[model samples]
Target chain A: MSAVGSLVAGSLAFMAPLAPAAIGGLATEYVGALNIALEGLILVGAFSYAAAGSIAGPIVGFAAALLSSAIVAAGADLFSRKAKADPFVVGLGVNMLAPAAASILSQAVFDTKGVAVVAGLQSAMALPGLRYSDVASFAVAAAIIAAIAATPFGTRSRAAGMSRDSLAMAGVDYGRVRGAAYFVSGLACGATGAALAASVGAWVPNMSAGRGWIALVAVYLGGKRLGGTVAAVAMFSLLLSAAAAAQAVVELPAELLLSIPYFTAALVVIVGARGSARRSARRRAP
Target chain B: MRPGFRTRFHIETIHDAGGTKAAVRLVAALASAATLAALAAAFLSSEPSSALRAFFLAPFGTEAAFLSTLELAAPLAVCALGVIVSFRAGHYSLGGEGQAYAGSFAAALAAPVLYEALGPASVPLSILIGASAGALVAAPSAIGKRLAGADVLLTSILVSQGVIFAVDWAIGGPFRDRSSNLVAMEALPRGALLPRLAPPSTLTAASIVALAACLAAAFYFDRTRSGAAHDLYGRNQRFAELQGFDVARLSWAPIIAAGVLHGAAGAMMALGARGTAIRGMSGGIGWSAIGAALVAGSRPQALPFAAVLFAWLDSGSRQASILSDLPPDAGQAIKAVVILAVSARPAIAALRRRR
Candidate 1:
């Protein structure tokens, strides 16, 4: 394959983990409760995968990841709603809790808090430059996105965010809709985490890194539109892959190289916000 | 003008989130934290009672431990003051981590050279340099918020994370002390470091500074006309605008001021006891400061006590790790629970209905 072809393929594989998270976040975004705990959920999923995969197998790892992340995410949502807490604060709390829980579990189960290699993961499934998990994650994300865009349930969920009272008056439970959204968000983020760890065959501390945050950013950068979010995620993945490619050719600090995508996202968000502000101002002018 | 400030900004003012309600929530949060600490000890340790005892009592066990707790609380108190400032001004700036880190690195880098030229005067000067670096990092978010209507929370975190990575590279790659085994910058001159308040305690004048800052902040917010304007601006920007206040300046000034405070706190971490800029030193301080600020109900006068409480939990967790082999992150779990609990608002209607 040509270098360009390889780069595109690699970027798609990179998207395997991130795409699910961004798509999942999109669900919560429509429900008017952004899941700031995407980061934590991803970590929970990855740690669960690492632990379970090393013992049972990759399939079991994925199943455990899905179940654990869903539980945590759903539990946090229920707690926030019942306690009448700000979901955003609850999300940040989850972010802190996830890593601590991961570390504690690692120490308890694996007797190490640094890294736990998932043996036999490498031999489980492989494609030219991708793993089966990568394709599976992509398919899952696409299905969720399609469901969200086309389903009547999706419309009600979106309405729940935009006008909760309207939905409540319409006899739909806003809390229930949001609760369901959070569950789906958890499941997708779990898949994201599992794929990320399975790709590397090890559970490194903070293995999810900031991918969850990136996914959240993608939700906003895509203008909160389904197509735009997908495009945004793709763009970020491509930039990451390009940076990885550039490292072989340029003598740059790896940290600096790794920071480029975040820097670009920040710049884009700022500029986009500014342009929208100006446009709104123009529209309001006599 | 563009909908009421309540609808448009949606930044929770201290008035909305704090006071007696905050106090009740705080007590509940602390109790939950203790319960969590106990559970974690029970699950993680061979000797659960010992672990629980170490976690609950060790921070107050010895004079050294007490002083260390105070020392940890100082910077936290300072950072919480910063968090309170932005939060009160209705800007949820989440860039404290980056701001503090940039400040620490800047102070560490400036300390040695400044000490060579100015002797003891270098300490404050380096701190000032650190504050400037923090302000530089935060300016983009503030400006973006003012000019572009950008969300301060998102922009601040994005800018901060990027700065953190860049700073990490600088600390680990170029500025790293080759002779040292740690990923950190060279130590500041001993003269440049803060003078310890008590011998062998590692406690410095930072505690005094923190106390002074809290007092001054309390005075400024409660006893002054400008502070009233700032508070009003936070609670209802539209009303403040109608009252002839400069809403434009108020929108962004508090965030910059917060950057200054966060930077100072970061500088204190380097100059107080560490005397060096260590990679990841600013890791949990930002989040913990937010927790401390919330526990204080965003009230400056209450920040010192809240900071000490958090510091005690931190110290006790460390002690537990040493005494009973409890994982140190158990402290973090307790803190997370506290933050979540304190932020909760149990429905008055529901409570009355239950009654």
Candidate 2:
């Protein structure tokens, strides 16, 4: 029972860090834009958190990450909306630019290709007697999921997603709503990056390692529902943790095991076309 | 109606259409010329006169350096040409990096065994083997798209990363060269080396083959019905479907063609490097190819010029580092600036026209 509980909690904790990106994916579709720059946004957020944590406290680091990501998200929005560039291409260019910039700065500062440990950030801890950090992260994720599901803003965002012109007819500024949602989503992602950095006590280039895509898969698997997204993320995260732990007992290369989550996500997306039906049903429901 | 009148009407219409086409062509040529001049002026104003001279001419200052630059640009041009095909068909193949690596892996594996068995005959066989390996690795994404309605952009990217990690693991375990500490496979046999075109300059017959391939691609695009169909599909998929074109088949052709070219590039790189497959042997050429494709606006003929420009920057950066205090990374920065400039040009022009 204890082992099961721990496993469930661990999965939830892992899913928590993924929520912001899942939310960003959901929000992008709503705003008539594809948030393909999520990977780059996450990288920038991670680097910002690390840099700020090394200079200031963990709280400041988190704030810095949020600010930087919001700036980047805003820039992405401006380029896509005002410039009339292809969103997919521009998003890819943004993705390429981030890693190159990060690598150049990282090389200049640390004289290394990857990132170094930030000094001032607080690592995730068990709070003296209990494993509070993991539990708290899970709880925070759950609360955010519930809030988005229940809130008027979330409904409005969903409405915008379904049909931007219809939302505009209802006197909602679709662009502003999208811009705001993307900003908030980026902040959440930044905080998640900060948490990951704090928990691990170091950063590496490509540290997220397609986790942003996993979040995207979770969104699709969950049919863009708050509860379903959480459930999907938790399920995959558990698989990831189990795969990691299995490295000890199995002679197979860990890389092969690490591929399981991605393969699983792809399989789910392919086989479970039912998610689209559920989404349509939700649209028709009260 | 008489047949003579109908034929006369048809000739007149053709003549008028041809005239309009010639006028449009003339305008486009002028626009391109003006843009090139503007770019040159911008460069001249920003740098010292001597620096400007070196920037454009340094790569050609010596026969050896000029040849080496072409050799480096050849594989990049091939990969970029592949990217052009994929992009022209409206598919985002971000998997070129992985595909290239896959080909390299196959070539590296085949090199030693074939060299030992067949001596000098192993070279061409190894190249063919490598190209096939890349195509095989890339085939699944297209299959996934057709079967599952999966997004090629996402699936191809994930598969690319998976292939890279898998290759890394294989190198670390089964193919690990125990004699070396650098985590690379064993070196290829001497007989497997590609024939050099010029001694000590890395120029090889592979570069000539790549150039011929580029020209063939250009001809195919300009003079084929299927090529026109591809253009139509890229411009408007629903319209193409309405016109009774098989969208799936059209999309698949360009993607597979891209994979083949990228695979060929990998084989060429392995052959040129004398069968050594280092991690990152493609040296971000896939990404550079994407950049080149974007700059060329998915035109096969435009790829060589864009690729040469990139190669110039790469070589000029090294030259600049030796002659001045600027770092080699400065070249990378300049390349980034060029990408930003080109991507922004259309938007800037559109805004101006609007005003």
Candidate 3:
């Protein structure tokens, strides 16, 4: 493959892990409520993938991931809306809780501190023609984005997010819409977690690393638009791929080099946000 | 005209009613407690009685165990104190882990070098070097937030991951100790290590320092003018601003203070662990500190007691595994359950509200 093609392939693979965040962002943009617990949701999904992959098949593992994510998301939503707890705080708590739970489970079941290798799930394959699973994941993400953008529910969801009261006044049950959106977000997160494990062929504790947060950055950079979010993910993935590819040639430590993509993404978002805000202010001024 | 105006006002009243703040506080508290209870139950069932008993009581059963618990809690208490300050100021600095690691790395790098040059005086110097390194690492995130409106949480987390990876690379690569089988740097000289307060136990002078720091923080947070200003800013930034408080300046102070405490904790860990900075030597203490702060509801003075309780549970769990058939991991599961139950009390209350 050409250098560009290899980069693209690597980027696509990297983007697979980010699918959950993009999907969650799409839900928030549509539903008018943010799922602040995306990090926890991802963690739970990852653990569920590991656990279910160990006992049953990948299908069961996938189901477990989706179910676990939904439960966490729903719990977060319920707490935020009904209990009146801060979403951010509760989300942080959930993030802590997920890994601890996963670590304990791994240790109890497999006598491992961080991971468990389940051959059953590892052997799970994609449809024969697809060749690689990442291609399928990217395809699904694109489809979800396209479908959401083209739907009326999506339009209403975005409107609700902008102003819940305004949407409510228009006869939409904003709470119900938000609840549904969170469920969808959880499902997406779970799918991403399972896909990530499947791709790696093993489940490592805290495997999502900071990918969920990275996706959030991508969402911000993408301006919360589906196309833009996908583009941002693609851009970040490509950057990471390039860094990884250059590791052998560069004398720098791989870990420090691995940090380049994250640092670059954060810097780009910061700089871009400031510049755009300034440009808009200039345009608004006489 | 008057009737029409009155009818419009009545309609507006209904709209305003919808905006009435939900009883979220009561719900949050209940949900948290329920989650803790459930987790505790799960953990208790998963382990044998002896393990459960040991997990809960071993740290308090003997002096050595108690001191060891304190040794562990000291660093966590210091780190959590920093988290509480940052969180109170509405700044989520998740980079404590990273900052702590940077402090550890600096301490490790400096301990041997400083010991050779300064001889007996290297201990304090190594600590100072570690604190400075931690502060430097944390400064970028603080500046990013203050200058560019960047989210401190994201920046700090990113920086922390980068720093951790860098530290790991340093230990595994250039700084690799040829004599040891484990992946760690060269150990510091005997004089460089913190003086032990108790024989055979890991408790050291660093624990006393940590305790002093906590007491000092309590004074600063409760009685000092700047601390009061931080409290005001934290509770309501807009209100503080309206009251002519320098919310931004006051907020920055706490964040920097947090970095200092986290750095100190890192240094203490290095000293207590005998100079070598092991991977995850902080041992999820940063996260637990956050948990402790949350459990204490950001009351700085109450942190030590909470930290001790958490540390006790942590040590006891390990002891229980040794004494019983249950695995050591069961103890952590129990702790997680306790936290979950405490945090989930509000969710249950919310469910009640819905009904």
**Per-model TM-score versus the true fold:** 0.95, 0.82, 0.86
TM-score of candidate 3 relative to the true fold: 0.86
Report clash pairs, candidate 2: A30-A161
What total of clashing residue pairs does each candidate reach? 0, 1, 30
lDDT (10s digit) by residue, model 2, range B232-283: 7766788988988888897576777788778778877877854577665766
Superposition error at A216 for model 3 (Å): 2.0
Sort by lDDT, best first. 1, 3, 2
lDDT of 3 by residue, A1-286 (tens): 7777766766666777686567675676556443445776787887787787778877777778878887778766776666454455566667666776776667767778666777756533343222244554555566567556777667777777668888889999877777767777787778777777777667787787777767766666676667677778888878888888778678887988887877777577556655665666899999
Best by TM-score: 1
Runs of candidate 2 with Cα error greater than 4 angstroms are: A1-13, A107-113, A127-152, A273-286, B1-61, B314-337, B345-355
Per-residue lDDT tens digits for candidate 2, residues A8-125, read 6556556656766676665565444556677777787777777777777676777787789778877777665665555555566666666666665665555665768766564656
**In candidate 1, which residue ranges exceed 4 Å CA deviation?**
A122-128, B1-19, B347-355
- DockQ metric for all predictions: 0.50, 0.16, 0.36
**Which window of ten consecutive residues has the lowest lDDT sum in model 1 chain A?**
A120-129
Quick one: best DockQ, which candidate?
A: 1
Clashes of 3: 30
